[model samples]
Target: MSDPIPSADPLDDLRALIRGAPGPDRGAVAAARARDAELTKPAGSLGRLEEIVEWLAAWQGRTPPAIHHPLVAVFAANHGVAERGVSAYPASVTKQMVANFAAGGAAINQICIAEDISLKVFELALDVPTPDITVADAFDRTGFVATVAFGMEAISGGIDLLCLGEMGIANTTVAAAVHYALYGGSAEDWVGRGTGVDDEGLARKRAAVEAAVARLDGERDGLEVLRHVGGREIAAMAGAILAARHQRIPVIVDGYVTTAAAAALHAIDPHAIDHCLFSHLSVEPGHRRVLERLGVKPLLDLGLRLGEGTGAALAAGIVKSAVRIHAGMATFSSAGVSERGVH
Candidate 1:
């Protein structure tokens, strides 16, 4: 068999990103759990959320989960299918929303600020052909690889964790198409009322996806399918996830669109899933299907549909709590308590 596709090494780039902080420490997690058990609460009283925090603590290799340099990366793009009226909002909304994120006016902005997380934005052109999109599209494969390689590498440095958000009008349509191509599901299974599409708009969105799938029939390669129907932001997010895994940094994924992108990435490299955490269940029809296929239970289920990493950003708190409990809760032996259930 031919050699497997090679991904860049992220450790060196991470060293530069973090200025040399060590990766997570297993020992710190043990110490933190001991402290947590001593806090006078029943063992696991905090429930699964506490367990999540404990895991985060272990992931961070720190007793207490820290957000000193938390990072939220938002990728924006426009889809050609939006030209067919698949989304309730116009394609222009993609660029406009990117502006909203830059100005700190979107839901993700508020949540990230509230959580004290640093946010960065990247533009990848999957379909839209505007001049700005041209500049964003200038990166060739090597450049694209390096950009993701460096971005993931840098974000992993001293950065406690990473969250991914996406903005692209009609992006859900692109996501659905990618989902269909990768998973062989009907467009009905993957399409949803993106950005509040009305019944007529929803029908059009589904048709567009179906049309895209029919057009690409017989082509099963993930990258080829993405090129045929995927959006730039979707591709960039995939690259970001790959980079995160390379750096051993955990990534919290947002809603349907991001999940679709992730599905495509997983098709390319199954190992990428190891570093991902599903943030929430989107009310969007396709979101749950993709999550189910991924075999990941999201941390939250608030009927959320907004993209831009809002769900993941909100879920970060739950992850922090889990890490806290994992690192802080006391083990049975550490608490000086005798086992009561033993024969």
Candidate 2:
């Protein structure tokens, strides 16, 4: 039979996915909690570690959560805004870094190796940078929808956990602009010294963010705001977050830029990122603000701002430890340890 014709509305499928997103598995959560109580440890002594295990169980839909095939996916793109000198690094660094990733020379490569996780770098047309948001919308509807589709396709290949990150010169500026559009604040509230820009560069970056948000004229839709200000990598990361929700894959989001990308989804549906874990608090100033806005606490605070999934990969090790502790520790009965308050 011939394949069914695609829907006329480009965003119809995405809308349905968001509306039909799944909730946590109560049975699995209960099972995890029960097992935790039986473990030879004081209740709540494990702290966030215990909470992490429960989150995994709820999202993975299993009694005890596991991370057998954790994958870190990094999307790299170039931005037209880089031409405005918002970042200290040249756009060529994005391409060079992609090559470095391929050569196993980047920090992410080493982290994945250390954590025994798989790393995949996706280059989103490094040659074709998205339009400078300060001057115009970054993407038309069709292009934005297509980039989101690419992100959805990224979730395939039987991965159990997903870590989302991005690489692009001036992407921090792009992310700041998106945040400015979504959450009403001054450009300084959203912009940061990406790649360690100088005072002049920081001022230019702030101006770019202000102009980008002003050009939008207070648009309300979350996805529309993203389309106006987001680049290919940010759009793809947002798409991957949504796709992971549908596929039941828990996500670990990297620092500032990734959080900004996720903010778009959060705006679309407050609970859209329920399955996600913020990996770290970036040194980037706006990261803290965005995290506060989302009301989600991150797993680490190491003053890390380097993108390329480095922070997420590091946090993945902690997650793996939580799973191991949950699954490997002996129960009170098995360990013959007397329960508290026993006669």
Which window of 10 residues has the lowest lDDT sum in candidate 1? Answer: 130-139
Tens-digit lDDT track for model 2 on 1-343?
Answer: 9965667876666766776799999999999999999998889988999999999998999988989999999999999999998999999999999999999999999999999999999999999999888898899989999999899898799999999878999999998888888888799998889899999999999988988899889995678888999899998998999889888999999998898778988887899999999999999888999999999999999999899999999999999999999999999999998878332
Among residues 3 or more apart in sequence or in different chains, the pairs in candidate 2 whose N, CA or C atoms overlap within 3 Å are none
lDDT of 1 by residue, 1-343 (tens): 9964443643234223323323455776677666666654666677766556555665555666655566888888765566677778877777787777888888888998787778887876534432222112223444444544544444545566888888888878778888888888688998888888899999988887777777675676555565566666776676677666555566888988888767866665554465678989999888878788777788889999888899889888677656555555555577765545321
Report the C-alpha displacement of residue 249, candidate 2, in angstroms.
Answer: 0.3
The residue ranges of model 1 lying beyond 4 angstroms of the native Cα positions read 1-40, 54-66, 125-157, 325-343
Candidate 1 vs. true structure, TM-score: 0.78
lDDT agreement with native, every candidate = 0.69, 0.91
Off by more than 4 A, model 2: 1-8, 341-343
CA-only RMSD, every prediction? 6.3, 2.1
Q: Model 2 compared with the native: what TM-score?
A: 0.96
